[model samples]
Each structure stands twice: as C-alpha cells, then as structure tokens.
Target: MSTPRDLMIVALDVAPSRPLGRGDLSLALAGAEAYDLLRTGTVRLRGDRLAPLTGPGPDRLAPLPPPGPEDGLLAEAAAALVREEPYEPLPDWLWRRGRGLSSAYLAALEAEGQVTWERSRWLPFRGGRTVLSDTEARRRAAYRWAADEPVLLALAAAVGIREELTPADPAVTDDTALTVLAAVHDAVMELEAVRQRRALEAAAFANVWRGA
Candidate 1:
C-alpha cells in the first residue's frame, strides 16, 4: 500500500527518494502530520473530493494568487532536495494571475550558495553556462508548487485549529485522514495543471511576440 506521503510525492512530482533540506523536511513532516490527523480524525475532511479545496477551478478566467511566505520557504526546501534552487519574486502580473513562487528565488538561492542548480550548461557547470529547456524550467516550477502546497494547506487549516501543523492530528482518523489527503492531492493536481497551461501559453505568446 502506498503511503500518503508517497502518493503526494508522486502527485507533486517530487523525487522523494533523494535527500531533503530543512524546509523540505519540514513540509514532508507537515504532510505526514496532516495524514496522521486525517487518519486519527482530529479534523474532519469535508466537501466534495473533486471540488476546489481552496482555489478556483482550472478553467476559470481569473488566476489564482501567488504563493505567500510559507510557500516560498517550503519551495526552497523541496528544490534543495533536488540540488536545485527555488524560483521566486515572480512578475506582478503573473502573481496576480495566481502564479506561485517565482523561479528567480531559486536562482537567487543558487547565487547565495544555499543550494546547487543542477543542469548542463554551455560552459563548465561552474563556468555558468548551463542550458535549460523551457520544459525543464516548467517542471521545476511545478515541483516547487507541488511540494509547497501541503505545507500551505496545513498552515491554513492550523489557523482554524489554533495549533501548529503536525503529522498526527488529535481529532482525525484513518478514513477521514484519507479524505484530507485526497484534498491535498486535488490541490496539487490543480496547481500542476495550471503551471503547465501557463507555460504553454507563455511559450506560444513568446513566439508570437518575437514574430517567430
């Protein structure tokens, strides 16, 4: 049987088999806590499994809000696990349209020596000549968003519970825990879909904008 964490990692496209960073570890723990809580029944997982848990549907015209501070921290952690940097400080327009953390943050982290950005460059890896395809860039962004979603969800739920996020909820049970996990699964899927759609749109727009 696949554990909740395993399902989440796959859904978020995170390679859980690799080592993790502090923030990534924290997020993973938080996800585990949420799973436990749901399993124990401390918090009830309500609403339709397929319904939007916290954001608008994928087909909507309005964009979702960019990730907040918690998201940034979690994303940083996840990227570190992959030996990459977390993207950040996205453009205002994209943020308003619900773009998550900016890829710039990861670049900034790499420059700061907080984490390594893995990829083959034109020059030596250390010579700063790494080459990255648009698809690779999009995948990185998706992973960051996926890893951060659980953390954000737990934090938001914690606000109502008046407690810190944890792996075990005093009030959740196995059945309900699965429901909550499903909610998380839904959120990750939505985020990934949005990221891919935006990337495609951006690529097309770039081509048109450049008269290519």
Candidate 2:
C-alpha cells in the first residue's frame, strides 16, 4: 500500500477520538505522496522543488511513469505534477495538491472496502460514522505505525498526531525524505497561521455585529 494510504489508515485507526483537521491531513497526505514518489524514483527534488519524471504532452502537462503508483489517487497526484521548468516548490505542491485531498482518499478507501459506514438507525439523514475494515492494508499500516516508522511518524506529527517533531530518525537518512518532511512541517505551520487569522477575523466580525 502507498504511504499516503497507509498514513490515512493509521490516522483513522489511532486517533478516531482526536479526528484530524482535514486540511492538516491533506497536507500530510500530499507530503506522503511526495516522499513515496521520491523513494520510488518516480520523482526527484531539484533543490526543494519537485521534478516528476513524466513524458511531454500538448498542454505541457505530462503523463506519469509507467505503472506509477499502485493506488489510483497517487497516480493522479503524479499526473498533477508541474511538468515544466521552474517546477513547483515542495510546499506549493503540498498546498495545491492537498486541497480536498483528504476527501478523495476517504472516498477511495470506501470504494476499496478498506472503510465502512455505520449509520444510526434513527438518524439516517445525518452523517454516519466511518469505520476501517479489517483489511491487509490496515494491518500493514498498523505495523508500520507501531514500528515508529520515520516517514509515518513525521507525517503524523505534521497533523498533530505526534506531539512534536524530533531529531531525524536514523531510519530516514535519505536527503530527499528529510527535505520532504521539512517542507511538510513548514506547510502545516503556514496552514495553522491561516486558520488563526481567519478565526480572529470571524471573532472581530462577530463583535462588530453585536455592537451594531
């Protein structure tokens, strides 16, 4: 299973009570995709920018390498890569690709029978709870998460699952992975800043409305 998918499963399984912010999860997912692509040699970092190994196309958008990622969502991410020179910066790519990415992964997991919905009988109109299925994918993700696998831990930390980002894990010695993790951390912080600004704006507006 792909790292993003595994990360999603691990997030759902471990923190059902905490429930990740979708925006944070999406950023982490994008980072997970970046890390996996780098690991697989389907993409490389040209000094913190992504350079997907894709073929040329008419509109400058390109196709992914043959048999890109086994997961369709990940393959789609590869296709979304900026094919031209001045390739996208890692943080930019995360924000762009991460928009609604959590929903996409959730839908994909539902379709693959990796997740199921349990609705209250009396409140059928309301949204139901999503439960992970007892699948091999879940087991594999659980094992990796249990092992404190560096990539997964880093991704989880970005989403506030882990308390803090620590020194680099010896297991994640690759420069590419380290770069991707750093970008993820910065992107998540940027997102949190945006959220804070929006919240403050809303509160100010509310006070103005009350005064008026």
Candidate 3:
C-alpha cells in the first residue's frame, strides 16, 4: 500500500491553486485526519509547533500595517507562502500590486465561504512608497495561517497515520491506533468546515463587488 508520505509528495507536486478534484479531496481529508494522530503519538516528533509553520516567533504573529517600499520583500515572501517560486524581485509598484492581489484573493476566499475574516487595526510604519504598520503584518499572517489550516491538517494526518501503520500489516489494528485515526479524521473535518465557510464568504463578497 502507498504510504501517506507518498500520497503527500504527489499532492505537493501539484500547483496550490489547482482546484481539488474528488480524489484529491478524499486523500487530503484522510491525510488531515492521520496527522492529528501523529502529533499526539508516543514517538514525539520534533518541530511540530505552530510558529515554524506560520512565521517567525509567536509574538511576531500579529497584525501588520500595509506594505511600504522597504517591505517589498513581502511580495516574495507571500509568493513563497503559496509555494510559488519567486520569478524576479518585484519592483515597489509591482509589490503593492501583488499585495492588493493577495488581499483580494483572501477576501474572495472569505466571501466564497472557504474562510472567515476577523477585523483588526494596526499602527503604520514606513516602507517604500507606502507605510506598513507592525499590526498589518501580524494580521496578514493570521489570515494566511487560517487559509493554510486545511493543508497543514492534511499533512499532519498523513504523517501520523503513516508512522502508525508502517510497522504493521494493513489488517492490523489496536485501540491506540484506532484512537489516533479518529483524532486525525476529526481535525480534517474541522479544517474542511473552515474552508467551506471561507469559500462562501468569498463568493458573496465577489457578487457585491460585481454588482450582481
């Protein structure tokens, strides 16, 4: 049988924005469930913290101001977040444009009911042509984190299940293994709920903007 890692390797090779096909969705959901088990398992894997997945330190995970000229690096960073290789260093104007595009994409996702938006304010700081406050960066991170929940859950579940099942035959089962699988399933479901909500919100928002 193919292991979770093998499945995930295939998934990651695909583009992030690729719409989830039925098979893809099934695998992703299963993977998310398996991940929860791994985290709570006895093996105690290292580097499971939310900080590394999200960004810098926990404290830095706050809302940040809009990007400025100096913050052009953010565009590259954002592209990286989506796992897209940066093409060229974005110019100040292009960086701003990219930021706007990223925000719009998030907002669209929210309107479509794939995610939710929580409002917060931040103090502004200078960058290039625009000013970015620390608060805005934090806010962006929060949104990004939320958006990434589904993928993360999938990854975790896949790893967890793989670790548990690799040593035994496909038919083997113990109470501990069963419990871990259940937890993984539960986590994936929660993430799916969030994604659905964001998608709905994004659709609604787009409708309003389009005046339809």
The C-alpha RMSD in Å for every predicted model, in order, reads 15.6, 5.7, 20.0
For model 2, the superposed segments whose C-alpha errors exceed 4 Å read 16-19, 48-67, 165-171
Best by TM-score: 2
- Tens-place lDDT per residue, model 3, 1-212, is 11232233333333344343333334333332233222323121222244576753211111123331221222333323211222221122122222333243334334444344333345234332212223433344334334543334334333342222232324314443343344434544554677799999999999999996
lDDT of 1 by residue, 61-116 (tens): 11122331233333333222211122221111122322222233344444544335
Q: In order, what lDDT does every prediction score?
A: 0.36, 0.80, 0.34
Clash list (residue pairs), candidate 2:
none
**Alpha-carbon deviation at 202 in model 3, angstroms:** 0.7
**TM-score (C-alpha, index-matched) for candidate 3:** 0.27
lDDT of 2 by residue, 127-162 (tens): 889899999999999999888888898788778776
Q: Please report, as a residue range, the 10-residue window in candidate 3 with the lowest summed lDDT.
A: 57-66
Candidate 1: Cα lDDT at 108: 42
Displacement of the residue 8 alpha carbon in candidate 2, Å: 0.5
TM-score of each: 0.30, 0.86, 0.27
Q: lDDT winner between 1 and 2, please give it.
A: 2
